[model samples]
Target: MQVKLIFSALTMATLLGACQKAPEPVVTTDAWSPLAQRYVSLVLALGEHDKSYVDAYYGPAEWAEQAKTAGQSAADIATAGSALQAEIRALSATDTMLRLRQHYLITQLTALISHAQTLATGKRASFEQQAQQLYDTLPPQRELASFDTILAELEALVPGEGDLTERVVAYRAGFVIPQDKQQQVFERAIAECQARTLSRIDLPQQERFTLEFVEDKPWSGYNWYQGAAYSLIQINIERPIDISRAVDLGCHEGYPGHHTYNALLEQKLKNELQWVEFSVYPLFSPQSLIAEGTANYGISMAFPGEQKMQFERDVLYPLAGLDAALAAEYAQFLKLMAQLSYAGNEIARLYLNGEIDAATAQSLRQRYLLQSEAEAKQGIRFVDTYGAYVINYNWGKDLVKNYIEQGGSEDERWQRFISLLSTPKLPSSIAWE
Candidate 1:
């Protein structure tokens, strides 16, 4: 049985009303443009200190070169970012859009300064603290005992096991997409997602992406957004890929996910509104919460209810030479597994906070997340490298889902979802309640 998630009517009304209200008239000249340019420059400068800071930049080549040549230290970058933040604060904007731009700048600069300070001092904050300061939202803390109900349910679903994790893993092993069939299945899934997205949202005809399979990554998939509405999407094939991942990664990394989100932002915010800040994506900012949350939610938006399972059963199963009969059961199993997604965040919090050791965290992940030894090791690597970013995938998705599905028809939800993707909205701006 499929369960539909919905927010309360009151929450829906509040968000919808917020979206409907008109902006105040512009009382001041455009002071934000200069600040926006400086914001981009500061991000590039900080990127020199931290290689992973600037996730994507499609802005001017000279700016990047200048940033590199200037060779600003993390401390120097933090000072400059503070100065920029002060200037931005001194400005006033009565218009709604201008206010949003102002808020976005302030939040992003705060994250920049915090990141730079951490780099300079080599002192990282606690997982929760870092998640709040860096991503502008705190992931909910969940107890390991809280997941026992879900585990019991999964037990009923997959009985007869030496270990529940081993049973689940063994059952799932049959559904792995073969290496030869991976490309075709993924291409087909991406095409369907693209077509569905095009039906509702207006994107640039020139918007496109190149997909590649690669190895040796902490994360499963990545979208390197190039300027001009293009992205280089890569999938890590070091571990076996289950058939369900075709649509999941397709919607997540490609169409109406990272690719579409970047394209719309490029076309609407950067090119149309002439907002320079949107041209550069800083990985450890509030913007990432929105980017990741929306991308994860995009999978369900593109294929609601049983539609995803049906697509896989009818189309992808044959393409991958998978057993179509197991599609529904596998889909159900995956849904149950998703109930345990937040386990990663909890594990990260414990391990990063020194409450648990690496070995303990790995064991917890295998038990809760039902990950194989290799997968659990990779997950720990992700935590070791990215720290609290593990929260973005699940927590971000929940926030996005709550905001977009407050109360609406499928079409109405798409409209709101597109509006979210094509704006400067941040995690702080979302009405979580």
Candidate 2:
């Protein structure tokens, strides 16, 4: 009986040992998971380094940090809940879509990584050298023809402090406004913008006008990048809308402008892998050209069938609380002023880039922009830092506007434009009829 019991115990041990599974075969497949993780980490580091560039124009730092946390699904969401709660208490609250996008970016990355890993466990995507070429190619725009004319008109009004270049650059940079009137001018400018747009958009009366104003002056002319929200601030300066100039700036910075277009593209690229490459915002190449062109032209999209008269009489005049008769007279002057500004922007670009001289620069601004010496000086600083991008503002607008006109209906134009905007790759130039 003892021997039999011992035999049964031995047999059971053997069966248990056999039931234990052996280690599976090591599969050598292309895995993108590790690479995705590495890429996200790199992007986050870049954001940290570039934070200073966007400080004034952007919102609080906590919001961007919260977004960074949100973009990592592998981390515990509940653990970061407190940090997000803190961000909500700040001045610029995160919107629902932004929050969702943060997580969506990470989750999408997980899937991409998994797919890539299954195909080849070790291979990863490499960034191309062509990325930096976009920035290097930026050359200034020239408005020599108009600048010559405006110089004569403005020379008598304001004492010519030398030439157009110096005066225009200085004035544009906030040098012209008296210290006391700066805030007043800024406030009134913003108020006028809000009032102008309230009646134009097809929103219900109850849903009308909740325009959120941030300090746009500091970062008004620069490109915005993503960290937390797709854009931390609206670069839209609420200047008294000169119908034409307002439309030009509005299109470049607002609806069809930088903010709107970026938000749209970011939303489309919510996938993790896409965010790693595209959302980081390299300043050069076809990307800026396409982005600038589309945004510069967006004014036409938002105000299709818009007339210059309606812009001034209906929108701009009402916003400033001006009388109809006085408004009409002022509107014409504003239109001329704006066109002059645009033309001067071109001249600034040429002069700063060494294509033109200081004398030529001054001539260009004074003649084209109708600059007081102070204003022309302000414009000079702008052209120096930015280079030829000024041309993009007007040239892009013309290109897109013409394209839309030739393409027939607004919807049709948009359909074609959307296709262009949707690509992962950027085109060097926009095609127009």
Tell me the lDDT of model 1 at 391.
85
lDDT of 2: 0.41
Instruction: State in Å the error of residue 182, model 2.
Output: 12
Over the stretch 1-433, how does candidate 2's per-residue lDDT look in tens digits?
0011011112344434433332221223323223323333433432343342122112223444654655443233222323332333332316543333343333323322332232233222211111123221233344366455655654443324876445544433322233333333333433343334333322111111112233324234343444222232232333322223444444454444554455445444423224333344433224455567777555445554435446545655454444445544444444445556456555654564467877677655655665555445556655543344455455555555655566676567776566445444333223411
In the order shown, what is each candidate's alpha-carbon RMSD?
8.9, 20.8
lDDT per residue (tens digit) for residues 1-433 in model 1: 1112122122343434433322112212467777888899999999998888899997777789999999889999899999999999888878777778888999999999999999999988799878988899988888988999999999999857679989988888899999888887878888899888888888775566667888888888898887676677888888899999999998998778998998898888887777888889999999888889999999989898899999999999999998999999999998999999998899999999999999999999999998898899999999888889888899999989989997578878897899789988888876622
The weakest ten consecutive residues by lDDT in model 2 span 1-10
Q: Report the poorest 10 consecutive residues by lDDT, candidate 1.
A: 1-10
Candidate 1 lDDT: 0.85
Please identify model 2 stretches exceeding 4 Å from their true place. Answer: 1-230, 234-251, 272-275, 305-312, 326-346, 355-363
TM-score of 2: 0.51
